[model samples]
Target: MSERSFEGKAVLVTGGSRGIGAAVARRFGSLGAHVAVGYRSGRDAAEALCAEIGAAGGTAVAVAGDVAVPAQAQAMVGRAHDAFGRLDVLVNAAGVGPYLPLAEIDEAHCRAIFDTNVLGTIMLTQAAAPLLPSPGGRIVHFASRLAFNPLPTSSVYSASKAAVVTLVHGFARELGPRGITVNAVAPGVIETDMTADILRERGEQILAATPLRRIGQPDDVAGVVTFLASADAGWVTGRTIIADGGLN
Candidate 1:
């Protein structure tokens, strides 16, 4: 609604160099939120995003860390507070997807995906939760439609996201008494670099199943994430809002 609704708020977005994460960073920054874009790699893109936000008169800083590591996750939050004043919203958009069939899914691959999608979320949330302001502090994690659909070769990824939704529900209950809200956004078949090939192959089938009959954009999901992290969503907590265009 208002352009400066997030004025004075500070947000940390992980994996914010590109795709949905990048869109989320821009959306929050544009709304007057001081943004910290956290990236594991893709330094150039992360810097560019920070520059773009700065050009738009939004405060932003780029921080690099591997979400898979708890220390790194904490450092990312530390940098955000060091740059801005404190953290208001934490968006766990850092995740990894490995498209391997259930039978072929190796322990190493599964561990890698879970490390980023689940454990990383836990670590980041634990690090930022205390720093968040009580009344309207928010935490939003990115789950996936795959959690429900059980796609052909995404066993590990789907399981990890399912865990994320559970984590949201549990943390919301744990943090509710403290006045901090925890929630999640589950996206389906968004048109991002991660879904390029799937979009090319099963695009028709996916579109047909989606009542909206269209592939979603990163911004489509980002808008919902910003709402979840804002004061407007103060009453909502623990639930995972599905942004799948009716695919699920």
Candidate 2:
């Protein structure tokens, strides 16, 4: 694809204020796409990203809403559509991954993870699917490597991501006739705020196991997302790209 291949496209990235979501938004913005940076709480970060994109000769807006809430998720997509008039891509990157042992995993904790990771993806897709242009719509979701290789504390979080992988298959088939592709990226141990503690505690151990001999970065995963959203991936759907730096 050309450097500015996404020119004239509009993207809405949930959880776009920081981490992988922010990188995805920036990638889209740099490629000439208008972006909607959706965030649940990081208003300052979200607006700053928008300002940065605008200063760099791109268009972006900070949209605030809780993806875990169905009404809020719909309204968030609606807000993005209002900002750009059309939605070409929907990136569902909003998620939580707090780890807890099975014994300590209460109903509240499990619900929180599922509500955000699973339900949020569904609600956002439902809202954006109609607005996306037929024969070219793209939906990229953020799953996790834990869904494939789980740790003891990852019981709940892994289950949530597994649900996402299943949804990708189901939604892709449901939306295939419309030419809207649904897919996911499962990242492993990316160096983001979400993984700082894990890296600090076991960075060396992880690097030793990873064939790439290093940790993953937000941009590393972001590139995969943008590809899935780009024209090159038109015939690809219901797939999960593993972005683990070969750790698994």
Candidate 3:
């Protein structure tokens, strides 16, 4: 693809301050898309990323909001649309994963994971639907390999991601009539602060299991997301593209 394949596009990426979200935002910005980097807490990181993109001749803005909240999701979408005059892509990357056994899962734990990983995605997509132009808009969500591979001590996280996959399917059908395509990327063992502890604890085992014998990186997943957001993926929808290095 050309460096400016996404020229004139505007994208709102929740959790764009760090990890996979940060990589996705930067990738889109570098491809000439105006980006709105939404962060729940990492204001400094978000602002820094926006500045870096701007300095590189890309347009971007730092948007602060919690995707888990309906009001904040609305405002975040509104701000991005107001800034760019339209919306073309929505990347739902904000999520929390607390690895815990099923026996230890509690109401609070379920609420936290589901609210952010599932509800937040739905809310933001709903908020951005009207802004997205028919026959061209895209929605990309983040899932996890664990959703299907399932492992010990990841009940809540896995279930939440499974929910995301189901949501993508439903939304793809519902939005297809509007010419919007919805898809997801399921990553495995990505190297990010969120997964640092797991990588340290099970790095060898993960590598051994992966056919590629390597842990995934944020950019690895970002590339798939960029594809789903591009015009090349116009006919693709309701699919979860896995970026797990063949770990599953």
Candidate 4:
């Protein structure tokens, strides 16, 4: 791909301060796209990422918002649109995964998971839809392998992700008339702060099950996300690409 393949395009990545979100933002910036790194609390980290992208001769800005809130989601999208003059891609990487067994899963726990993972994705997509250019906008959502291959103590997280995949399918059909493509990526056991504790607790079993015999890196997921946002993926929509290294 050309270094400037994404030139003139603007991307908004939620939870872009760290982990897979950060990697996605960096990849888009590296490809000559203007990036808006949206964060909930990691202000310093988000700013640092923006600086790093800037140092690499790319355009990036850090925007703060809590994705679970409708107003905040709208503001984040508005800020990115105002800053870049246009929005081409929206990556919903902001999510929360809390492992709770069915016996212990309560309404509060379920609400928290759904609000952040499902509702957040919906709100952001709603807010960005008007700003996205017609006939070529892209929407990439973050799902998880657990959505398909569920495990114990992850009922809420798994269900929320399953909802995300369904939402992507519905949105793809609704948004297809506008020329916008919607898709989701299901990443399995990536090496990020979010998965550090889990890896320490179940790394051996997880690695043994994975055909690759190793944990995935954030960039492994980010690369697929970048491709989904590229023009080459124009014909693809309403599908979830699994990035689990054959763990299933």
Answer with 1 or 4, whichever has the higher lDDT. Answer: 4
Candidate 4 local lDDT, 38-61, one digit each (tens): 999999999999999999999999
TM-score against truth, every candidate = 0.98, 0.99, 0.98, 0.98
2 against 4, candidate with superior lDDT: 2
Off by over 4 Å in 2: none
List CA RMSD, all candidates: 1.0, 0.7, 0.9, 0.9
Candidate 4: give its CA RMSD in angstroms. 0.9
lDDT by residue (1-248, candidate 2, tens digit) is 68898999999999999999999999999999999999999999999999999999999999999999999999999999999899999999999999998789899998899999999989998998999989899999988999988988989999999999999999999999999999999999999988998999999999999999989999998889999999999999999999899894
Per-model lDDT: 0.92, 0.94, 0.92, 0.93
Cα lDDT tens digits, model 3, 1-248, are 78899999999999999999999999999999999999999999999999999999999999989888899989999999998999999998998987888788899999999889998989998998888999899999989989997889998899899999999999999999999999999998899998999989989998899999788889988889999999999999999998889884
Q: Which regions in candidate 3 have their CA more than 4 angstroms from the true location?
A: none
Ordered from best to worst lDDT, the candidate numbers read 2, 4, 3, 1
- List clashing residue pairs in candidate 4: none
lDDT (C-alpha) at residue 6 in model 2: 92
Candidate 3 weakest ten by summed lDDT: 97-106
What C-alpha lDDT does candidate 2 achieve relative to the native structure?
A: 0.94
Give the count of colliding residue pairs in each prediction: 0, 0, 0, 0
